[model samples]
Target: MKLNLTPLFAALLLAGCASVGSVDPAPLPLAPGAYKTTAANDATALTASWWQSFADPVLDELVGRAMAANTSVQAAANRLAQARAVLGSAEASRLPQVGVAAGAGRAADPGARAITRYSAGLDLAYELDLGGRLLHERNASALDVQAREQLLADARLLVQANVARSYLALRALDAEREIVAGTVAAYGETLSLTEKRARAGDVADLDVARVQAELAANEAEALALERRRLELETALAVLLGEAASSFRLVPATWATALPAVPAGLPSELLQRRPDLAAARSQLQAAKARVGVAQAAWWPSLALTAQGGGASSELSNLLRSGASTWGIGLLAALPIFDGGRREAGVQAARAQLDGSAIAFREQFLLALKEVEDQLGALTLLRAQGEANARAVSAASQALRLSDTRYRNGLVSQLELLDARRSELANRRAALQVRSAQYQTTVGLIRALGGGWATGA
Candidate 1:
């Protein structure tokens, strides 16, 4: 009896695969039910178009433009497209490979006479995945495509958040410049009055000098604010993928509505962050690759066939006597190698371990960011309230001091002090409001846009 040992060898190789043990990954950090710095919960779930919640048309337009034009976002999109193409190629690999060929050749016959032959043929090959190698490879590629998709989402989120923050900072500068410009005007008026008093000998030259110094200082501050504002504008231009000189954001009232976004549960963040989703996909892909590498040690089976006709004359090739055909069953088993397959499996498992650890790190960072932004917003609200009160009190004090000084009941120094105090308070209040808007954006980004989990 004839005996075929291919099946027996395949079985033994599969058994060998069971001996390649995988290292168990360390446990992931537990997520709390709620963040330690959790705020009041709101009904707002995360949405992809989270920027619209801010209710600023200019901001909305800028974000849209940046999403379309930013180089980094474009690069991420290209990567996604490439990964999808690779996935298509992977999926197509399981299908039979077919080709057509036609050729004409001249050769010396056995009798030393020159002869010409014409042939046309169709060739086909199909690999049978008896060891699951092709299946695992396809699965790995599919998972990688998923990872690339999530990475694209992550890139968009980053660009949206940055555009919002930069625009907010620019608006804050507009408000600050308004305050400083007003102070400069007031200081200029005070200097005019002080010079008149010095000419009439009603006040000393020291008072005149102090007023002049205050006016110049306020003017200098106003100029500095303008410079900073221009820089921000230029920075924003770059964010929008334009030349700094060509992009100009007109100064306008700070009217971007600050949406109250509450911090959701910690569990929600795991599902909402694209970066985390990407890491998870990558980890799964690594696991799939390990299977592929381990499968390399097993046997592979394939089917091949070729059909053709050949004759001395092209027309004669169609005759039944000139027809030719072939079929083959190919089997391959790795009898011995210098540990290449084993090394591949080991390397694949190492990648799996790395991916798992990376996923854990990503989760930890996501949790920390959400908590950090939540805490900042919570504190910023109270700080804004206190600063507003200070501005109110300082304004009232400044009015009183101005009236008293004009009536000769107080020194000009006290009036200058009151004005300086009021300006400082106004600036502090503006800074606090700016922080509130920027922090809300941060919290929104940390929440992964509107609150729903990443798909």
Candidate 2:
């Protein structure tokens, strides 16, 4: 039978143009216009280094160290480098491959004189990307590199937030410890007075016992705060990539001034979050892979050319008669593989679907995080105000009880109770303040380092 390849070639060319089955991802349902708690008119965008807003030099230095040396951040950076290398390799594969080879061999037969042969050759081979397979593969690799880059950004952001929170917690603990120490000292003075009054037969021994118990309790509370401070210091050291045992943060006060963050329109959030960007990049990569899989169902064409010279003597290898050269074209069409190509196409489509869904989920998650932090800050601020009033009132009541006790107008037990209430109120106020600082950090992170109006 005489074969006519025109129709076959035409059909294959047209099939190669078919699009992948993967669907393009679209914007998902997220919070609308503006955050409920944040101002809508402020237009400043989030700073790249949001931790600087804390205005603490120690915290700033710690965050910087974490970003530079934290293990998670370092690992992510390495992954980005690897992805870039893969992308380079894929792109290079699209061009022709050329190489040179040289060899020498000696052979002897039982009834023949020994002889030597020498050869040298240059070869070139290239897969003609007539089906767009190589192009799509390279596109996928490029997207992978973008995804890895975003992942690295996410890692850095997490490290910075962790370091900030740890350092702030240590300071909060220190503040609370100071309050306990103050209470302990007050109890000590009261105990001394009760002992003197008892010796003078003006107060009973029970009064002395009560004051001693209060002093012991405050001292115990102080010890617990110290332990917590030590733990936080160790955590911060690890974040800075240093040995926990060898690292220490000097006692410092927590910064109460929280910089107001701009919460931009929800639409802009998709672009600001690194995790969302990473998900979107992965979706693009998966879509490209679908095209690659579809391309595999069609025929592949390759062009190869080689020129070489061979001779018994190395000096004569390049002589005109001893030289040789050839050119050829190769094609491969999937004949049958038990539906393997179909399975691959289905798998690629499935992966594309997964990636698209993942992108949507990531968007929703980011929105939820932002809202949660906003709500926390709002409520915590109100609670903080209430706590401030309680502390003030308790302090005034304690002063009255002390004066009355000094004049023997009230029992020692009543005076001790007043002191305890004052200490508790002070500690509660400190806790609310600490919570505000911590939640503010969370809000910044949830907003993807910061936000800008109209962003």
lDDT of 2 by residue, 252-361 (tens): 66654566644333444446678877887787788789889889887989899999999999889999878889898999997988999889989998997787677667
Total residue pair clashes for candidate 1: 5
lDDT of 1 by residue, 98-178 (tens): 999999999999999999999998999999988788988898899889989999999999999999999999999999999
Query: lDDT for every model?
Result: 0.82, 0.78
Residue 191 in candidate 1, Cα distance off native in Å: 1.3
Residue 52 lDDT, candidate 2, scale 0-100: 75
Every model's TM-score: 0.91, 0.90
TM-score of predicted model 2?
0.90
lDDT measured at residue 224 in model 2 versus the true structure, 0 to 100: 86
